[model samples]
Target chain A: MTQISLAKCKVDQLVKLCEEFGNQEGELINVLHKAQELVGYLPREVQEVIARQLNIPVSKVYGVVTFYSFFTMTPKGEHPISVCMGTACYVRGAEKVLDEFKRVLKINVGETTPDGKFSLTSLRCVGACGLAPVVLIGEKVYGRVTPGEVEKILKEFN
Target chain B: MENNITLKIDNREISVPKGTTILEAARELGIDIPTLCYMNLKDLCIKNAPASCRICVVEVEGRKNLAPSCATRCENNMVVRTNTMRVLNARRVVLELMLSDHPSDCLVCAKSGNCELQDTAIKLGIREIPFAGEKSEFKVDLSPSIRRDASKCIYCRRCEMMCNDVQTVGALGAVNRGFSSVVMPAFDEALIDSECTFCGQCVAVCPVGALTELSHTNRLINDLANPSKTVIVQTAPAVRAALGEEFGLPAGTSVTGKMVAALRQLGFAKVFDTDFAADLTIMEEGTELLGRLNAFLNGDKEVKLPIITSCCPGWVNFFEKQFPDLLDRPSSARSPQQMFGAIAKTYWAEKMGIKREDLIVVSVMPCLAKKFESERDEFKTNGDPDVNYSISTRELAALIKETNINFMQLPDEDFDAPLGESTGAAVIFGASGGVMEAALRTAYEIQTGKTLENVDFEGVRGIENLKEATIDVDGFELKVAVAHSLGTARKLMNELRAGTCKYHAIEVMACPGGCIGGGGQPFHHGDSARIKARAKALYTEDAEKSFRKSHENPYIVSLYEEFLGKPMSERAHHLLHTCYFNRGKEIIEQ
Candidate 1:
């Protein structure tokens, strides 16, 4: 998934993305993909704009957007933190590492800080089992993460 | 048959289509397989078998784990065990888990007797709360017509399917995830804030009390008890054909006489029929159609052709929100319900030597939108509504039972005069193509100045999504079209927007089978056969009537001559006619 924020595009850009898919009913998935690619998220307003341009119901768009986990309605913050919770990482001190990050960030998993500077999310294996407790901060991978290392990693973004 | 697949369930062999699901094949052999989240409504083209509930899981011979019968398609030589020890335990466990999270207060529940989950639990012989956990509590949303009690929701997704697939309203949807998942409007907003047409289709298909009609029974009961107020009730044509189902009568049974008798016993001062006003509607709407047709024929391009019928409140809200630019295309005459309310409160109230404020007109309808329609400010004077209050046919049945009135044994009765007389044309306003046929019955004869040999317009009579028929009126071929359900209306509207529509008039009802399948009628439990039966009852009533045309009704003729000068006259326009406003932004004459 493209984790970086692409919500910088104008509202009209999402409408154009839907029209570029020929506004066909069968191309709903393709149109949603292109619109999400431009807007980074499918908020209710963006979905309504796309629904009008595609001549489809907003509920239909929402159904498709929700059926797939790759789509998100809320925009990711500037620095989204990920703590791997796969079998390899969980056997290690990944649970402690995730708790430390939550304590330092003062936000639960799948939540963004009030300042929008950082987001805490959990993921499965990133195929980097060598570093059992892996943490990613905005596309940067940190191997062999520790409970005490969470503060240092968050400071790197601020 | 081609591509036949043989399957065996509980040692019974059966042959079915290749794509038939295991649940369906088992049903074909009279083997009942339990299900929770499966709803199939073919008439509206809505089938919701997500199989997420897992209550219909069955054991396959070779498979290690059980498979959902609803989703698992039958294969040739497939061996399925529907009621084995393991399958029974699994179904019971699923029900227990669902009940653990669901509220157990079924005594006061709105859908106490009709809930599918409750029936299944009883069939399973569940008695204890073995598992207990935190229940998902959601704030109840009570709109003008529908109630959303998310705490009672089983995540069946029936309401979601109806809104998304059938009506295309897109108001209700799945929100959140995991244990907190719920069906709600976009961003979890209230339904009134969303594009909900208040068609009540969601309430109709819901198998539990999660979704239900907001009861107006209490307010009406209080009104009926007040001696200072004169409470008069009007019954819709569709209500008489379908209300019988609530009283243990068959689906197609017409209980018109019994319904009138029950209304009288309920202590109403007067019992009226909205069909009388439906005939009045034809007089006004038929006149409007012919005037537009004549104008278009005389080379007047300013008048919009294909004058749409605006009798359906759901259809009215639809075009206002979805097709605001073409609001004037529909007839400005108020619906039969509204017309009866306006005339009863004004014309009849004056004839009875009473003030409009002292008269309270209650309507028993097969619609939920009629509740919202009566609340519109344009149809009110000094904050008093034209129709004081409207209740659904379901609510009326409950009131009858509450008052200890045995509906089955009630003697036959007749409707009061002046505003209670109707013709066959008015009785047909309940079905899908009934309005188009009624208008054609009168418009054809008036345009040709000759009697119509065949009053039944067969072309616009079935449950087709869109129907087209052309009538030869005085050597003029008047092309007309009819469509029921908002989704189908979208297609016809698109053709009109493309400038490719060839019809001179169109009739649209938001419900699939028109008023008979209304959101407030007795629940069919997603059975289209019941809808067809109700339609048959209305047609049968029409055939039995002495006068089959709107203009031929003696009361309507006297209504025009004694009071209103003629159709579309200044007096008729003031009492019977109304206007449409752009309702896209939700500023409903605020």
Candidate 2:
């Protein structure tokens, strides 16, 4: 079996975040989202613990985790970049930005770097058409990005 | 209508039943309130209760934050503005968020024109999305009757609501929460492995291409490529009446001959008619009905009550699900579609001096459950399934286009002899109350031992979900009830369960308006087109054919004389008639 690391600190932090929201009973999804955000992915163990605390079945937790496209159950690199490829973003050259990310990292979408420094993924339009070709790296939204700007954007994350 | 509430929608006040949602009231007032989760009236009351998707948000004068009109009950003197800028902006934002994770494959997606999400996007004039998120990647669940792609789901819960509330087959429900919430069967099991009846009701209600009908053309194509196989195709009665709609023809255009020509161009060895077997079904079912009536009148030892019609597999499956205890009430006649398959593999195969295995039988039907029926263990006569592949009417049109068949230029041709000729009674089987009408036409004459002056049972003909009629024949009053749609059938069944409904026979079809509005039929905007097409085609087919009655068909009479000996004969009972088992356990196990 392939051994996977637990995002233990991030999981505790996410549970606390859910508690802050005053949604203790209804915070499984919120906690999962925060956990994914902190650790860059939601591992199976994180989901299990969340399921237990929430009094929801592990299978139910896994089903929701597997159903939505927004949730990832694997580990991400130190820095994660998501480029918007939604219809608006697509028509406005988000694909070019994505291609640039693929070239700079030498890794496709959903791939992490060999050195575990950076990861890339494509997203649907992020509702910011005015800021077409938007790229999000660790809560920072880089607007009006071009293929030429990808290397510059990555250096900051590095 | 004692407790009606009047509400103002877009400046127009309309009085609707109390507890009517703002959406329903708006709809009643000719005010269009855009909704993602709502499907007509039936979807209004569903658990999880229109809470997930906030797209149907509308503004009320006194309400804070946008209210989902689908969930909010209408109040007297309530002023609802559906087209306000705030409501539009909120809807747009919600749509943008939903689209943020959707796959960018609409060009090749099956739901391109018919997709609600795409329609909403275009309607909202949303040029872009602002949120960047990870796109969900999922493998396609290509089961027998439906395909599921979780990647495209907006999770509006329309399908889940329809499955749980309307059909009451809660095979699907939301599994996870926020962003990760995916609708799936229990334990993420394969749909085919689940108790899913493959009714395609989920597909019919799905807003996006998240759910779709599985293509059977690949298997048919493979059969056509094999030299050893003699592939024979049969078109259902409703298919010809509606296949033309997909080709830009008007809704009710009867393209029976053109359909035959199109099939010939597709290179099938023989193109038969399910209508022929429909006539055969009437013979067997009619006789069975007569036998049951006789048994009941005589107080026979082994008598089954009710004698429900079994022409619709969806209804059969529904009965198996909700009314397992009443399985014996259903007549033992195999559906005409299944009977056609059995006869094709047995009688036709023997007549042509070909082994049943070498004969590839394909049925084109206005139903998706027929796909599941073809796979049923009871449908098999020889070592293999009688029907190898079942394609929907829309799929047939797609296959025709795929082969580049010139549908317009093809000359009208008759179906192959012996198994292709069908009576007018068989043709009308596509519409609601058609089975009851056909059975009455034949049974009246058979029972009274005299030919009736007027063969048309006008009392039983129409588009009503539940119709009751009593005919005086040979000084005996024969009472019959016809119900289209499982919801309506449930109402009649409740009456039966309450001992209030007493009838000699009844016909129940699972789909509303019978096979014409079947889940497999072309997507009409509303019931008007469906009802018009069904009514026109049914009456036209009846008027055109010489043999308007089932017993009057020479081919059916010949079939009974040559092979089966007579209607309801021991051989006929073996091949055509079947026994119903309590399917509550079977469905759960599946």
Candidate 3:
């Protein structure tokens, strides 16, 4: 993953987000959430800014960011793709569907395409068990996702 | 009486404090409980009782499961069984499961004989790990002062606590989760690249082979074997108090004479004392303090007050990284280890007719940061370090044993002349408040020009993390503060940064109880009494000396007269004084 420099980020906005939470260490998760929303991901430079504002160590901020699955250190593409790897989805061949997405997009899990169009990731239990194999792109959930439909899913993003 | 609670352990009745943990109460009763992830240094206010390691679990009456004695608080009528059959089985299973994933390369490990895990395994009589599983492996991380082997880590988090909570360094933390979890620096940055100050407190607390000092004994051995080099060794003040522990002697036994004899046996050309350089440090540092004080009194607004001692390399790295804006506030005097190296390679080498390149200066210090300090670019000449390398007291002890020299059987011998003689003021530099007191002894007499009948400044002594004292020198009140451990140093530095500091001088040491509790000293195993004992030994040595002030050392006076004109002179400044850098700029402002 390429390192996103702080020069490219809206540094002022990051400080404003920390000030929004009164710069308290207790509000770290909330600050990280807002930071990810502002910069699309929590990079090293962004976490450093938040840590400085919160009067804590950057290592601690990074530790918290890595602990929870919601926070991402690398930037997601314009359209982020997540394949559900829940037990129900796995029983219905979600692995094959994920593999199809990997082959079609030329990118592996936790990575983005070079064209900045799509990124792929996997999650456990998206709570759409009735749909068995499930896949989510942004806010749109495609139930009963098949390995063959992986191409169709990419076509819509394109 | 109301605060006291009665409790029973293995049918023995005992009364304890209301909030006392089962571990402490059981210890009072002479119950030996095996623990892995529990550490408590009460004197320094450092405690790491994560209870993640279930080896300390014990049976409790009317409880559903075994309770972790290290964290479980005692209550009235509570009955605990520390060595019950069920508890033993549970502990054995926990140990087996932990050993299942842990690497079993104990023989070649750096911490093999001294490892607490090995001792516990022996005590438990564990023949083999019944559980078999895939072990987690990781590449070893090496730094100038410390080595981290995550594969040997038991997810104890003792290092994590010492780094983040106690030292406030925040270099190591618990990352990832479960079987894949390991304590590491942020973003997996190397320790040298991270916020680590190379204090080595983490290594001091580690129970296994996970964290250990980066050994330089092998290099020292090779250097000694080379007949072309005139190898000289300098022993720091703290080494005398603690080196005895490596042998059969008690923690606080002063083995200065025997240590010099052992160094001679190790084939070192000259066995000098860093205490001599410590006396010279006072000459340089004391003059700098007086100059700063005089300037500050004359209303020279640019001069920084409360000149902090720069002898501790760990504390120097700390301020440079954490409080970079106040970098100029610290004294520019080089540490005794570096001063000895610089002077040995120059004045001493020239006097002995040995070339600088051929004269190798090695220091035995009670600090890991000394190793890092010896390698700093500014301390080097044309790419050759002033001090070739530094070995810890533990490393020196290992080298003695490795050389087949029986330390206990060695005769007590005096150090070599010229660079071996030192005053009592220099010997106390091992303890936390020793520097401040030593400076006061000289600074008071110099500032007042009166005969000081009472040389002892008893106020700035002891094992407290922070201590403050005010001395009236010629009716001019001189305020001073002494702080040990980076945690307390942070508190003092934060005060200085905020402009609320009222001290004229402050001495800060990175390790608890100063160099006596240094990271490279023999492990105290969370025993605060051992630290106090070391400090007492230093004070006792000081009381018995003829010259109690740094300015009174005859050799120091002659060296200044023959070579350097005076303290703070151009020659003295060039050889003894050094500067600080702003290491926080890249991370904080980039």
Candidate 4:
């Protein structure tokens, strides 16, 4: 069983955020998005609070959260790295670059480093196939990446 | 704004929409312009224009190099010779180049007869490859529900476009460049390790055997050879409607009994029906819907509006990834596949006096998503998966052929008594709006305290993506909504959020036509055949049935009386119902 604890200060902050976005109705998704941003993930305590504040069921909130790809409930690392492996990128060896990142990071895609410095993730084609082999470090896009460029990319992130 | 273009294709002058591609105009004029990468209007046109394959070249008047029709837009007055000598030679050259690197071993490949490449070669009358090059050597990926053979890929980008743009789960893309270009997941990660739901949409669109469903019948054969495991097979409601296509039986032919007999001939210990669990799902879900409605009436704090059906694993996964906050609203009742596993492990194990672990539950479904659903952590029953294995309808047909079973001569046999027995309400579980209709059949009866003379809720049954109905039951009018595809589901959800539509209940299935038209079902040119077949079989099964409603299912009544106490009872809620958590910002770490 996963033990859940409610942090009063954080809960109050989340409640204030929810109130800022119009208490109920369509505010469920808005509140959830802000909660995820604040807590890194939509933890159970935050969901329960949102459910109570919105006067909606926890199941409904969970269903919406689970149905969308954008939502995540777990804590993330300080720096997140997402590599695009779309058709154009794939044709140009984006996969090999990703493999080098996995090897260098000593962590698989979707896994964060033990020190919490970086999290590596792979995305389907980001519609940037023309560039071939593109990697996104946060909002910045690096096109035509080689396997050898992975170490330099990681150093920049750190 | 009114720029109509008249094009002469094969000597017929036809008017087409302004800016229509030459291929589209040609299609309207009933002229065939063969293309590998051009799939209708969906994919990117001809891999960066001027045609990479050059197969669709047509002799447009005054155009040099025989303009590729797919890339060139229609002009005001175009004289196109679709079947000229120059066009034929150009198509032949293109076919020859495509076949150069392709494996000549088409006879053994899964897509041998169905491959578009082979069909194009045959059409172009090319028996030999003129330009040979170093063929890419790649091993087969026998991952979860799909197989990948990169060596056979033509770099058509059909699968890539569909996966990234259509489904939006970009699991596969081109890796490396130039001669070494290969389509694969990032870092060569196993597909099972990614977010792929194994919907098989990519497989359906693939022009060659580069993508296929992973086959597990060999392991089944090995298990059959071993004297230890007691293997029992169950066919989903959708499989019976589509499996007949493999045989010369017309699509939608009710081959339920023949399907069972075929499995029995293949030496299975027992042949069961997933429709039985589909009935069981109705019993559980129908009662849950009533309970939720009652809770709302009573002003319960937990107001989970529009309880979504969680039967389609693909839809469930889609929701889990995209709408994690709404997970709690999904019906806690496991899908017919998962329910079959739970019942087979618990009740069937007790009835057979065999250890639950010893019974191998093999499911034949019309879906590739079931392959992934079977591996979900939530599906585990007492430490082991309730269902041991799941095989798609196509793979099962392949297995029957591999085992040298005489499917034509097999006599129809009945499914095993207790667990095999299902109601008409269950049979419709294969088609769209089936779950809602099944639930309504039982819920109306339960709520009204009177038998529903007409079990068929005609208003809710159809192939449309979204449907709505207002039923007057015992002076209470219930508004219901049904949506099958994600696009439609999104529409309904948006409407609900905007307060534009208010309904007591809403049913949404991820696929277009429910399980019958699932991503894992047989690849049909169009859904008309399979949809008609499934709909006809479901209604026919309903008309011929003694019990047409879930409430009338004696097994369900007895199960509730013996153990569950009642529908939505405390124990039943604990065992049959489960809570969902919001995975808001957590990436599903594979």
lDDT of 1 by residue, B58-121 (tens): 9999999999999999999999999999999999999999999999889999999989999889
Per-residue CA lDDT of model 1 for A34-59, tens digit only, reads 76777666776676766666776676
Off by over 4 Å in 2: A1-158, B1-34, B41-52, B56-64, B67-85, B134-142, B174-176, B406-411, B491-501, B525-532, B586-590
Query: Relative to the unseen true structure, what is the C-alpha lDDT of residue B416 in candidate 2, on a scale of 0 to 100?
Result: 88
lDDT of each: 0.87, 0.79, 0.90, 0.75
Residue B192 lDDT, candidate 2, scale 0-100: 67
lDDT of 3 by residue, B187-293 (tens): 88888888899988998889899999999999999999999999999999999999999897887899988999999999999999999999999988998899999
Say which docking band candidate 3 falls in.
Answer: acceptable
Give TM per candidate.
0.92, 0.72, 0.96, 0.73
How are the candidates ranked when ordered by TM-score, highest leading?
A: 3, 1, 4, 2
lDDT per residue for candidate 4 within B1-590, as digits (tens), equals 56478878787888877888888788776777788766642211112232556778888887776888888888877888888888898788778866887899998898888788888888877867879788888877776678888889988776665565545555666655566666676445566654455767678667789988777777788877767888888899888887877777777787887789889877789888888888878878887788888788789977776677878877776666546656766788878888787777776788789897788888998888788777767767676877777988887887787778777777788998667888888888888888899999999988889988887788888877678999988887888988875656757666765667688777877655677766556676433455556677777877898988877878777776776687667766654555554433231111
Clashing pairs in 3: none
Residue B337, candidate 2: alpha-carbon lDDT? 86
Choose 1 or 4, whichever is better by DockQ. Answer: 1
Residue pairs clashing, model 1? B306-B504
Fraction of real interface contacts that model 2 preserves: 0.12
Candidate 1 stretches greater than 4 Å from native: A1-9, A24-40, A66-70, A84-89, A100-106, A124-158, B1-6, B17-19, B42-46, B73-76, B585-590
Model 4 ranges off by over 4 Å: A1-158, B1-7, B12-33, B40-54, B65-78, B101-108, B134-142, B164-166, B170-189, B493-501, B526-533, B569-590
Q: Each candidate's fnat, in order? A: 0.19, 0.12, 0.37, 0.00
Cα distance off (Å), candidate 2, residue B186: 3.6
Cα lDDT tens digits, model 4, A34-145, are 8888888876677767865775534456555655557765556687888887777877888899999899989887678899888888889777777778888777888889
Candidate DockQ scores, in order:
0.20, 0.06, 0.39, 0.04
